[model samples]
Target: MSEAAYQEKVLEVEPYGIEPIPREERHGRARQMFTIWFAINLNVVTWFTGFLGIEFGLSLKHAILAIIIGNLLGAAFLGLTSAVGPIAGQPLIPASKRAFGKIGVFGLSFLNLVNNIGWLAVNLVLAAMALQKILPLGYHSALLILTIATLLIAVYGYNFIHTFAHWMSIIIGILFIIMTVISVQNLPALLSQSAASNGEFNLGMFILAVAIAFSYQISYCPIGSDYSRYLPENTSGKKVWLASYLGALTVCIWLEILGTLTATLGMHAGPMDFFAKLMGVFTIPALITVILSIFPVNAMAIYSGGLAALAMGIPLKRWTSAIVCGGIGALLVSFGGGQLADTYKNFLLLLSYWIAPWLGVVLSDFFYYRSGLAQNSTTNGWAGITAFVIGVIVSVPFMSSVLYVGPLAEKYLGHADISYFLSLVVSALVYRVLLKFRSAAVPVKPLQFEE
Candidate 1:
């Protein structure tokens, strides 16, 4: 069947995978990017990310500054990369093939698949935790229910996901606004409250906070274009970029600040518990909102993970992939008995360990290296892969994790984890310089696909 005909018939199923989305299948406004990102970022996991800095002993004022700076930087990358989707008409993995070779991108795709599944598990666990608190279901049952709910939405594919995000953005946005207002009523007093002794100003903690916040956004880099590829090719790149940036930034800052305020007020419970404490009799509503908000976020993760698996040459339909990925995440949540706070922190840091370098290579290749090369030529896969390895190696000594703090991390910068920064800078510079020495081979024939 013609790709367009297939797309039309399966309106609920995303027909195009690694192939460029046919122009006839592309029809959506740039503004939808805003709502999609906005809805996804409204997740409670984002709030928990903000609260990490407070746990690190940074004062509220400094932590907020780090959050702002980190989100701004991270959002820039997310926005720029998302703009590539419409022009390339492909998801992150396929788009990456332009810079990283067909073979090179597979390794990244495999890693991306793992990362997406990790994120899916984390989000499901958090939502399930909230639901368990609000309802009588056991934690395992709540995990199962949340995973199945998110999987169903993701299995319906792109159009349904977009539609779901649009409506959820409106609903959750209003509910959160109400929660924000209630929380803000006590903000003045919270602001005046002295920082916890652990919250004493510390440079190490400040940097760690920024890294965590930055990781939160950049972790989405692999999937940034997944949502935008369905938009028309003529869509204004600038508009798409701005809409995405504004949407994610607006929600992230608001929720992070709200999270910081909650932490400041001595709310040590999980995200929903924090909300329940603030809303009093409205706790049930607040709890429900928190639970429902995870749908778009986790759905995105599962959807993207499935796409990444396909990019890595896995043979499965998108819906089948979603089921497989969702099942894996549910299994982890059921058996992984670690405390939520510790698990979240470790996951965020681990996320940065890989993503920081990957972004560096991707941005450098796309903006600097590949832009100057011919459109259809074969890329020097080794250059990017080698550069990525070098970046990881350089990052190890600067990493700070519960697993192991690097020697350099403890010796310099007051034990702050600067691995993300170091890795990004090193990888970009290496890739850019390497590109000058390499030459693209002859134009390769395009893959034969119905699209």
Candidate 2:
């Protein structure tokens, strides 16, 4: 179960391929290809700040600072983790199989599935809320619209998801930009009216907001390699890094501006409310269009989640799993609860539990253990898994508000972000020590494609 032994085993290959490439020419330039994937996948409802931004009264400066910190951190991991795509020629779950082992796949797979389902629920809420505004449709009908839209695209699988996402991201970006420009043009007058408004904005809350934003995407870095796996092996690392970082940063910055401005204007309302206000100015059609933009993003959630399930030994095809899982997500909309507030908090906390630990493991294995060589499939690196578990355990105290030992610790540990940073160190140390105690006799090789 040592890291080296596990990697050596997983990378050992059979003399055959598992999933063969199609003979037909695929349609997509790398730029367009990853543009959409990165755009929609990166910007989830959490960016809107209806829950976080409006509640905290974060201003333009606060949002900017938060986004800058988040993007720098997020982009760094994106570059490091995204390199797995061209190298592995597989999705995230498969690539993760190297680190988690076949059994570890179950936890990762389930978490991914749950995450996608949660996103689907949130989108359903957005779509339903938008529909409620424009049409005579009640919440039920709107949920139906959300479900039908998600189901249609999700059935076609990854190729369609990628292509559709590319186009949608472009369109969504343009529309969102128009809205932001209008809002900014009108912001000065609006802010002056509320210049004497009473609202407390502190630096600590702003940092937490930024941490939350960054934490949302940080968790997905482990999965970034999954997307990159399909890329051409010769794709430049610099290009891959640049494409991902630029694509994500562009979208994140725009949304933060939009979300923050909307928050300030509708200081009396929520994020969804601000979106509604802008929609009214743009007209009903514009609102529907923006709401519909959720489809491409949801498609990604389902696709990534399904793949994660498969890697965990699910006994279903990708399409089948997507349908069933997505349907379950659609069903959650009936409750009219997206858990946006709690979900954002949990995601931030999970940054410590999942992302930081995984990042630590990957970096540790890659640089110190693997020496940049690929790892084998069957190798069970219990050291890494143990590290992850310990990371989660140690992170729990910081995650819970009730576990505070002091005011300073309460402030620091009360938030979920502490999980990510704390887990990174704990997991890395646990992994290092475990490797020393449990040695294995094998040489780690390149990642072996499943046959």
Candidate 3:
């Protein structure tokens, strides 16, 4: 397609790069966030996250409470960051440049790029495994099919992703509801039976469960604004925040609760197996829903990964970036296979370790320092970078992962990983103190872009 024609078909065809979106091109409903986030959270990976809570030794009651607390906390950050979209009129990375400065934002962009690609590969592998269970195809074949499908959607970019997610929310939402109804028939017996937790309350395990759930949502902060950047500038921030928050929170809570119930009942099989057991003869539809849901979720990952790469000074077009990112992810999945499974827990913990500190700095800069202005400034990026590094360093002694346990974590904390929480608090507090002493090195300037 010619450039002009492609621009006509899709809104914001330029892809904006680090530029703020022009007012004339901004168009979309704030409430669409409901469908976008709702659909995004409906997937096998999310269900697996809930399953991990049980594996970490939480009883059904504690698991549900932890999931609720984690989602609520994470959703608050997610919603606030997303609300910056229409106001800043840029993707998450560029908008973040306002706080981190041009150089410092690159640090976040690089980490975000890695996280996005890692998430895409993880999603594809899990989705492909579920597909293999339903069809006779091998894992490689299913992975290939899913990769191509997701790439096609992502190459079309933002408008298409929004439209796709809107319709998907309805379809997947109804299907999962039906699946839940079928599964609930056995809930009475499941609730009456004792969880295999040895009847002891473990605070350390409970905190770990909350961290897992919180990390899942916070992982999206780097890309939270990507979908909402096209909304009209005058769109109510409150509406955007509420819509996204409620949408993600509701679905996350429901699915995790269902997952907890299933695990508690000893039907601790993977998502497809549990669905097949409950749905019986209607298992085909359930399987189809699970497979169909992968596209929108993975497409978001591919799309946002490309945007982060672009922000880091990669000159590729958005579509080209999508293709490149998806190709790399596919290659990783093909070679890594089962080895990736072993790293999944550590991968998630590693994500929290970096992202929580990053969030602390970004949120503190925007709310406390910038007075909520979305304008970029010329400052020594070193201060924020120093604060972030210090946060990570301090968190080391508190981290507990299979890869390595910190001395403080193992000796005193009973193996609970509160490193993420510690990093968050430390980074924000340090950034605030540093900002008071440091002044901008150059005048603030608005970003410039070509028409």
Candidate 4:
């Protein structure tokens, strides 16, 4: 069967992998992005990222402000990458191959491998923890169950994921809205707490809070276009961009603020556990909601990772690649579940460090060199790789992590990590300069790829 025929049914395994989607196979409304992304962020991880803002020493108001600013910036990057899908008709990293050659994109594949596996492990561990709360299920048992459940959806591929996300978006959105109403009761106690001297805003920490939310949302940029490449080629770029921006921005802010409210109440526990406990008589239902939510978010991670494998020339189908990723993620969960809160925070930061520089090159190629967007070739890509490396090297000194704290971060940023922002700016500037120099010498024309 042809790719489109096999992929027409939701349950039929998808045959298209990293190859440019055949136009006949292309289908989906741009509005689906809004629901897909809205459902994607409706998970414990998104909530916890927001909760970290409060934990980062911000008052509820300051944390909310940081979240809004951070998400606004991050979601725009996500939308831009996602918009590339309909134009490029390939997975995100593959769409990027023109900027970075086929060989050069392997670096992206490696980074994506780590990013997806790390996030899948984190989500699995959290969902397992929630499952344990739902009953007396052992952590390992719950982890294994969720790992299988999440893998099934990922392996089932794009149509399945889209259909699954559509219904869950509505169902989960309503449940959370009800939960939001209940959460407001916890807010009155915060007025006195906000008046406390400890509520004084710390600049470094406030910026750090913004960076986390920014990193958490924009980190998806690497894999984002994979989800939307199936949209018709003529799909409105404005609609595509708006759907991605609003869908992710709205839910992420809502959940993060929701997390902020719960943290300010002196709840000392993980996000799922805290929410379950705070819900009082609604405990069972709340836990059930969390348990049900594990698949949508984690499936996206696994699905994108699967495509990254194909883009890297891995000799496996997308479904098979998803299984490999699932296995690795399960191993991560088994070996590292200690000090999870700290691990998750650092993981979010580490993700942005690489992605920012990478995105800088992509956005520059797409918008600045508009003609370059029409190119179907993957060249040696020295310009992009060089800019990418230069971006990372220059920004390392500004990076502050437990693994390594740059002198600049220690001396001036109060240990806050702003490496992401630095790399983004530096990389774009370097790449554009290189492009200008290259173009001035040679009449710039698109290079076509040959088999």
Candidate 5:
């Protein structure tokens, strides 16, 4: 292939697949991360996560606190993962090959691929619902439209994803501002309810609120670096971290608060009803705004999912993998159109189960056992996979969900899930300890500087 073919074109499908982005071709600044992430989280799902805070029985004040705290914690990890992108120059799941070994990473890769599909279903469902409001299309037809639109962006790959998000952030930002201005009328309803439940803040409910929000934000961590790998090799990791952290943190908290108020105003109805009531004739416009915003997030899920499938040794080209993922997501939406509220909550909780421990392994490998990440030998990292498995096993007793609340959560923690935290801490500590006995045959040199 000609060298010019390697140059990322403005209006072309991204030719690159899962390969590490070359430094010579790398472009963009860390701050661009701000727009991409901010745009991605503007959808109703993140808003619904906040509404869940109230649904879980926390006071509005407590829910907002939980939203802030959860986003703070989750965004930190999100930032940490994104910061490694320019240096690692590989897709997030592929970079894990160093820690999990080529074989062990497959399990994690599979988990990631599952998570991506679930998210794709989630975002597409949200968009389809919104699309159904404005267009003549039914839910299935709207879903079909969204599936094709998102697949195009994902197949086009990196540069297009970034460009799409940057513009969406500005457009969505204005639209949400209008919605928020109209939403101010509902704030009194939320505040009044807050005063009633304000003193009865249940610790279990509060923790659950934080966990759900944290889980949602941290859900982005696994795919955080996928977009940033195209940045210049010398990109400042700190700036990248800050950009991603603030971008997600800002919009997430904003939407969650707005969602809480919407829920309160709707009473027996839901947030969407609240939107319809509040906006009156403008309801169609609001839905259109929502439909437009979903593409950025759906694109991210499909794009990263394609990479995750490739990382797991799926023998297809990147674009082909995106097609498969989009098809599966559309199929999932067919079965999941009803019971969205319960389905979405359980989905968020389940996502935390595998991702937290996986985070433990990746963070340890990238930061503490830095040498392993730079090494080409995937067979040298069994210690990481071992520790990761142990962490997940240990966390099983503490798992809490409507699906199955673990005994430890019921017996001791009042059914508030702390398993996510336990998994991360245990995996990190164990991996650090195991590193002492673990040795590779080749002389190792830690990656001390950015790529």
Candidate 6:
């Protein structure tokens, strides 16, 4: 009743950096492991540290709305993809190939590459800023230190990261608790501030905020299955599903709520300034907590980037890939990655355009078209491509702002979150229509299952 549809024969596995697991060892228990995995991955540091909700929306309510909507939608997407993880026993990039086609995976990869690189760069600047505060070094020296530290973490690979997360979580969790306690004590009045004081309560801004938050992490969450794959073959998909859903929802709320509260309390300083204000007397512990929390998460980013590069046939070891990519990210930071906010906005729009449809096609293809939910043969189908193109085109008018082109455009057209819903609708519709013509295409292969 069960068989592995994809052959174990490694096709350029060296290049892809994907070593197939022996069939017998494929599944595992999801219990505490998934929670630990999810907890470590929560990585709310970037989301909060950057003042994204406040800065982007220019209002507390706007920020809150973005946070709430973004996390909810993102979690929903993660749930869809994660369910496929245990069943198929494949990582995100590979499973996605079924929808995007082999070459089309590049479309996803390219957008992901840009997004990750941009994110990595932003963090690099952030790390540099943090280091510069602690030390007397110039911006250049600080950036160098930031790059080297991030590289060291990245080179050590996942085992090191897992350990780092376990220990760091204990420490950071304590610090976060302390910080929250402190904030609540001093900023008691923040609770009364209106979320819509700056027009954040309006429908457009509210929806946009949610769209931004949702878009920010869609690329990141798709790869959750890659890490979750280490579980014992007997692991239930429900465990993975719960872990992923709760993990995203919890962190998004944690970070965003804090941010909204912080904004309301008038701590709306720049990133480093905000940290300085909050960490006043306990600067050392605060810095320690921040570094420990951010380092591993950034390492994971570079690690994933390297793996993706390897998967795309780059002749680099995983560690080498990490070092190379981490170094590049660090350099971007050193060279004044100050344009990160702008980069993020544009990237979000572009990504939303590409991914909304890609996701629609993937979900539609897997849940509706392909009966084999897990363990299947791979096919680079046209369904995803058609959806992707349609999504991008439809999002064009809406995404036409400074983020995509330049500052001049933003000055003229102003920013809006219209791209979010537009792309999703376009992608969903296009995918459905494409499925009608997909009959002549090669039938998707089902996963190999063992009886």
Best by TM-score: 5
> 28-145, model 4: which lDDT tens digit per residue?
9889889888899987677767777778888878889999999999999999888878877887676776667777788788888778877887778777877788778777788888
The Cα RMSD in angstroms, rounded to one decimal, for candidate 3 relative to the true structure is 4.1
Candidate 1 differs from the real structure by a C-alpha RMSD in angstroms, to one decimal, of: 4.2
RMSD per candidate (Å) reads 4.2, 7.1, 4.1, 3.6, 2.3, 5.7
Tell me which of candidates 3 and 6 scores higher on TM-score: 3
Residue-wise lDDT of candidate 5 within 1-451, one digit each (tens)?
Answer: 3354645565787776777776667888899999998999987777666787778877777878988888889889999888888877877767777677877778778888888888788777767767766778877888888899889899988888888899999998898888888778667765786676655768877887788778778888888888888887778888999999999999999998888776665366544565577777778778878788888988988989888898888899988999998888778877656346348646655755888888898887777544425455446568878888899999988888778788988888877888888899999889878777776533345445452
Q: Which residue segments of model 5 deviate by more than 4 Å?
A: 1-4, 266-271, 335-348, 369-376, 441-451
lDDT of 2: 0.59
Give the 10-residue window scoring lowest on summed lDDT in candidate 2.
1-10
Ranking the candidates on lDDT from highest down gives 4, 5, 1, 3, 6, 2
Candidate 6's TM-score: 0.81
Counted clashes in each candidate structure: 0, 16, 0, 0, 0, 23
Question: Tens digit of lDDT per residue, candidate 3, span 201-252?
Answer: 7888888788778877887887888888878777888889889998888988
Q: Write the per-residue lDDT of candidate 6 for residues 1-451, one digit (tens) a residue.
A: 1354322222222122344444554534454343444455445453463255565555665566567767777777776566555555556665666567778766566565555566677666666667667778887777677677777765665445555555666677778777777766755466456433556244544555566677655655545655555445555656666766776577667766776677665665667777778768876666656655667667767777776666566677877876777776766655444555446645544654566666666666666534433333355556778787888777766654334632322444345566656776778778767766766444454333222
Shift in Å, residue 93, candidate 5:
1.8
Candidate 1: stretches off by over 4 Å: 1-3, 6-11, 195-200, 270-272, 336-348, 369-374, 441-451
Q: Report the lDDT tens digits of candidate 2 across residue range 91-156.
A: 545555545676676776677667767766767777667667777887777777777777777666
TM-score, per-candidate, Cα-based: 0.90, 0.81, 0.90, 0.92, 0.93, 0.81
Instruction: Give residue 56's lDDT in candidate 2 (0 to 100).
Output: 59
On the 0 to 100 scale, the lDDT of residue 258 in model 1 is: 82
The C-alpha lDDT values of all candidates are 0.78, 0.59, 0.77, 0.80, 0.79, 0.60
